[model samples]
Target: MSEGSTGASVVPATVHLPDDRYIPVRTEDLVAALAREHDAFGELAPRLAHVGEALTRIVSAESGAFSRRIERAYAPFNPDRETVTVGDVGGDRAELAAILAYTFDKANYDLLEDTQVRAAIDSANVHGMKVRVDREKVEELQIFVRGRTQETRLVRTIRRPIVGEMREVELYRRLAVVFRMQNSVEVNIKLFRDIPVADLEALLPHAEAGMSNLDRIKILGGGIGAIGGATWKAAALLVSGTVIAGQYFWALIAGLVGLSVRSVLGYRRAKHLRSSQRTHHLYYQNIANNAGVLDLLVTSIGHEELKETLLAYALLLARGERIDGADALSRAVEAWIARRFHVTLDFDVADALESLDRLGLWADRATMRPLEPEPACARLEQHWRERTTEDYHARTLSQRG
Candidate 1:
């Protein structure tokens, strides 16, 4: 069996399933493995390839419809596109809000929960940059994340600030944030890659880097210390009566002026450091924005749907009799994936079954069985013929008009 990429380790006690729906195995390799394991499927390799192509077409058609809906809803809010002079954006906002959740799910991304958002904001970042977002300014906010992985990252320690130690960190391979400001015309959409969980706040629109308590204490303490030292020196000069009165007054004023300048410079320096950290964090992480994010999401939906359909059909064909119901089929497929590919994932069995049913490949719904390879191929070919015929008629009508 050709091995697939390894996923998160599965422990018997906890039995945690990854939220991501992405399959690590290549489609062709998976088909070949199924054929090798089941001799009945050996001759159906070509048919299986045809099934994949049919499914891809179906997914693409559905994704295109969704893309159109998203585009219409996003037309007014798209930051990259030119502004449209709409009397009221309320309708557009409503449409976008209605479909945003479904769109993210179709794209195989999990919504970041409110609790997770709060945790990210409350926790300190490994990079030591504190960030704050003005929640009142945000009219709408949604964050979607996919492909969670555990990785070791170098984190700066409080004691050893320079040479930080490495620690295990959970990160999202992709993050999409949709933000709309209160009383704003355009909504902002941003896509980022490989974002650390604790640094999610930094990716928020208009997230500002702020001085930490330690930074505040350092600046306040330094200012106080400097003023105290100058005050003591001035008192000594007054008591000794060695310096003239005018000279003493001038020296005290100069000391005060120096202190103010130092304090101002210190604050600016700290502010600059924080701003630089934030800029660097975002520059490396951001991957896409606005209309570009929508394009990527539409493509992801098609790919994920295709993967789900292929896996579900192949499993049903190879082990139809053994699987009794949807739950049983799901478990069977999950076990096979873990055993064959060494990857633990929660197969989206419902969506897979729905696709098969729609394509007329599923035979017994109760048994969760699909049609035999030959019959399945015939059904898929028929679907293609119908789809092409419909397209042709539509094009003819448009041309005639």
Candidate 2:
């Protein structure tokens, strides 16, 4: 695809957008989705131990600076608050340790702040966060973070015809800010609007990526208050607070907003825990299934070393230790092909993974494996959890608008 040129720097710094077709972001709707994200991680949110252990295991061997940073700086801010949910990870001990993180991208003007975010990335790289991409849109050039999967794609389109990357980051942060309001469909439709010229300068000055961790939560607390004022009042009245039975109905509004906020927070916490439980269940089952598969096909691995690798894969799967092993599994395959095909297979991890990905082995962060349900006779409740809460919320939002 040919890119639009901008004088000396050929990076197509700007993309044309039609004036009339743009959608103004309805702060409420985006807020609702953002709220949903927070609610999804509630009480039983993935424990700090899970991610910490993974980092200690995966990243410790790679970077001394990162290891020191985690111990000295990050560990103090663990978000899970030490809650080891009774059965969040099903029957498997490994899934119990699955690391869950809340990520926020930022651009830092201050060297110290930049260091902090870099430290988080360093930490993630070492400990093993999921494989993620920060790409601009191939289409409208709008931004989005596509996750809830193995491969997370975080798009950071600046949306401004003018302004540098840092400015775009603030806009992105506001985009995240406007996102923290009440759930509404009309709000999502507003994303099509052109980024307002007024809000552009204020939002994009010092933006970067960050972790929405409980420890670092203060970072978001300051911004979440960017929450729309009038709407929050209305919601509080409807959810839990007392509404007037008569008169100006001012009391009614108050009651509803107060009630709604409480109900919303409560519902969100429950929803988050439920989702984590589902994640744990799925990760747990994969471990069990892999182990079972290895048990039956132990000899099929062909060589003892490969057999050991398969066993390690099974263990990591069982443990929910998502260290990317596709690159290595690939090298082994190349050695195998060279022996068989007599064609010298170059050391190309990408191609090996591509071939494996086609055969359902290499995962682009999303598991290529089909989610096979257990046979009815061997089914276990510990192997599953309900995610119906999101459906219910979706329905409520649909009806409300």
Candidate 3:
């Protein structure tokens, strides 16, 4: 099998690639591998190409040799030996969330046949209580546990990602309707790289609508005519030249060929777009197990679309905060506030902001002003310190023994 590009001993698996050769894959490829076929790990590769320069630098370090080369970056990805923990603010939360959520939501929930989120949501609603989570810890996990619903003695946490800016609320709403599944599931994607709460929430509505349309226009659902035309053009090009010039018949062929080329290109664009939506879909479906009565509650209020929109928006709002009151109320509160005052608050609220804080709902602190993001993130200035001090000391002790 292909060796890990990061030079660590490869995980035991069977494949046809050379024992020493590494096959790096795009992050998207890893995601697709899991969604399409979980066991098809051999096909997925780390998106290590961009990091080639970084890897080369590490390999050249005096402490770094062939043994430690590719594995440096790979260390973050290994669950068994984590370089960062939930308490480590600088831990690659987004990637960790993506991989783990898929396991929890898909493998544990769907494929493995464990928790049924729809049922969990219901049980939690009936007997659920809310918990108050630490602000700094929430940043560590990149999730604000809005609230929880206890069912079968299990606390099912409900939450939403905070969209830093209020203006993106509309987008969050749209995303809820189109891609609300992300919220409904159990995977906590603390955050996407550089996709702040505001941008996601702002673009949510459009993203949702567009994704929904895209699904219909591609994948399992789509506009058949558009897709079919593209496929035909692609096929024709594969067999012949981009431009066919010759007989009168060739001129006629040219017209068809033009359509074919355009169609294939369109199909590819649609396919690429479709890939991201699948992640959102599978991700949400996994976490939604405990959305609580929100889904039914919204439906009862005759606001199914609104409710869906709210779910995605809600997750966007509570991304980096902590709300641990028995259930999803904190997250719900965050949603209500966004819907009401259109602002986000931090955990360190003064007594004066009480009414303003509670009026919005959820476990939020009072904002200094609208549009300014509270320092919800847990700073990781000590990451390298901990790496070199704590971990390195432990490694030394272990080796000495």
Give me the candidate number with maximum TM-score.
1
- Cα lDDT for residue 213, model 2? 34
Per-residue lDDT for 254-339 in model 3, tens only?
65666557656766666555445434533543323222212222222122111222222233243323433313433443444344
- Least lDDT summed over 10 consecutive residues: which range in candidate 1? 1-10
Candidate 1: stretches off by over 4 Å = 1-18, 24-47, 83-91, 124-126, 217-225, 388-401
Instruction: Indicate the TM-score of model 2.
Output: 0.20
Q: Per-candidate TM vs. native? A: 0.83, 0.20, 0.20
Compared with the true structure, what per-residue lDDT tens digits does model 2 show for residues 301-342? Answer: 112212222222222233223334655444444443344334
RMSD over all Cα atoms, model 3: 25.9
Q: Count the backbone clashes (under 3 Å) in each candidate.
A: 0, 45, 63
Local distance difference test, per candidate?
0.71, 0.26, 0.27
Q: What's the CA error at residue 165 for candidate 1, in Å?
A: 0.7
- For all the candidates, what are their Cα RMSDs to the real structure? 7.3, 25.8, 25.9
